[model samples]
Target: MRVPLRDTVAVAAGVLAPFVAALALLPLRTSVTHTNLALLLVVVVVAVSALGNRLAGALAALSAAAWFDFFATAPYQSFHIQDRADVETAVLLLVVGLIVSQLAAYGRTMKRVAVADATHLERLHGTTRLARAGGSSADVVRRVRQELVEVLELRSCRFEYGTLIGRPPRLDPDGSVQVEGWVWDLERQGWPEGEIELRALVHGRYQGRFLMTPAPGSVPPPLEARLVAADLAAQAAAALDEDAVSAARRS
Candidate 1:
């Protein structure tokens, strides 16, 4: 479990401040026994702040102040303050605790944001790599399926072209060609097990449909799949147009 940086710092300060105060007051030689005891008291405050939340920090601060008043002053073991300085010291300790906690919380937020940005950059890089791999529509499909299975950990994937009757031929599960307008079912073994119908786009035209069935109870397909699908759709459309042009020339 990640400890929020703010909580850690706050706790550290709470425990350290009293001992520091005692040390600073040591030169005065006001009360050797009382100062030593005050150092131990501050240590407890620090420990409490580290293990608890904002409420704990506040409680630790308050307890430290009370302990100091009761044991450190000339009026030993009493809450009465002998001077304005002592009162100010108690208030400052509480303020320090609040400040430390705030800084720690801010640090946690920044860390989370940084992680999110890194993930976005990674996806962009993957898409760019896919585009640079030139190939026929079937090759593109194969490459994409392989990438999805390997990188995205998808179980299976395929592309279909056109409507059942009028669509272009399909690249089957085994990577073989079949009649146009056929439905290709893409399946995976785990979570998010469902199917989506896709119509092939050729040269800005719809060539056919593609579909996939996610594994039972699998998590929903991530956004990356949709982005990849869009890219494949564009490639499919271009491939169909090329095929049509080739057939016309032959005829």
Candidate 2:
């Protein structure tokens, strides 16, 4: 796969920015304290972390430490640092840079999670609104089937009415999967081979089930997402039950 232009730029900057900054500081080596120089390099690491990714940030940190030892410390033009204080400063620079990178990576992860949660809520809200609007049963089922494919990241999904034919992996309301007779650890392991079942029930009545086929080598969705899918299935069942009641009254 081709890398994004922005990422390529970031990685290049991460590796080179520290070297450039250290060279610029060469004249000030005699005037500036070693601790102050290390702090300045930390700033470069922070900038790289903000612009790029964790790997970029880490590379920046390593580059900064190496250049600092070579150009700014005693035994100049070499990696070896004779001064103990300079040695401490070099080690600290690398440590601080790594920590900043990890924190940046964590912040990015939280942001993605927040966006995903909002999307899940919208899917649930839309389905509930449609059901309340007196939409047709087929419409409700169709909408739910589409939503399931998205929420669960399934390759394909279809609804089956009435009797369930055979034993398949069942997605429970609590987000646990019952396979054969045991619960599968979905987090560590991805979806099992073959089709999975998501049953839809209304007031203890077996309304229907959704047969979902997982994509080959697809990552397993989180528990929260699985719960949202189950909720959507429930909405479809409720819509079907409402239609059944209306037909019975007419008869």
Candidate 3:
């Protein structure tokens, strides 16, 4: 498996950075207070945490604590500390570094979620605009098919007009999956085998459905994405209903 370059850099830095930093401070050990030295090591931990993930941050914290004990404490170059204050400083350094790493990880997670939400909104807006453009019903169906494939991470998607066939896993508007009259644990089990159906309805009457074949071994899409796909299907059904009404009036 190919590892990401960022991760490789992070891991290397996490292990080596504390040693380099502590050695650099060795010359000033007699002049600098141990508390001040510990704070500097904490800064090194923070930098590694921001540059990489939680694992990288944790490695940095551990490295920073171990190096601080060996290089900064009494009996120079020895892990044993004669002073109680120095030992406390080393303990606090490790604890603070760990807390900072967890916070950094949380911040990264929130950033990713915000980006995903924005993309979902754009998909919905684009589909709504196409449906309102007064284009042919075929055009709307085609556009929706493309969106469904992307939003659901499906291998393929197609529109089926009128009449329900054999029962398959059904994607409800609420983003739950129903199979054989039972609710499938979609989030835990991923998509079931075979095709799934997302029905398009107007005022309780069926307009059509999109038969979706999920990509094998693909992670089940999040609820927010599934909801957006359902909304897109509703837009397609509304457009088709309007086109049918226009044809009847013309005749």
Sliding window of 10 residues with minimal summed lDDT for model 2: 1-10
Q: Model 1, 1-251: lDDT tens per residue?
A: 23446667665655555545544554543645544454455555555544545555565666566656755665766788787766666566556545554444455546655775565456445544554564455655555445444333445556665455443433332332334354333232223224444455654567655554434344433444545554554555556566668789999
What's the lDDT of the predicted structure labeled candidate 3? 0.88
Ranking by TM-score: 2, 3, 1
Model 2, position 20: C-alpha lDDT score: 97
TM-score of each: 0.37, 0.75, 0.73
TM-score, candidate 2, is 0.75
lDDT of 2 at 157: 99
Instruction: Identify the leading candidate in terms of TM-score.
Output: 2
Task: Write one digit per residue (lDDT tens) for candidate 2, span 112-193.
Answer: 7899999999999999888788789899999999999999888999999989899999899999998998998886677877
User: Which residue pairs collide in model 2, if any?
Assistant: none
Which rank order by lDDT, best down to worst?
2, 3, 1
What lDDT does the true structure give each of the candidates? 0.52, 0.89, 0.88
Candidate 2: list runs displaced more than 4 Å: 1-80
Runs in model 1 lying further than 4 Å from the true structure:
1-134, 148-153, 162-193
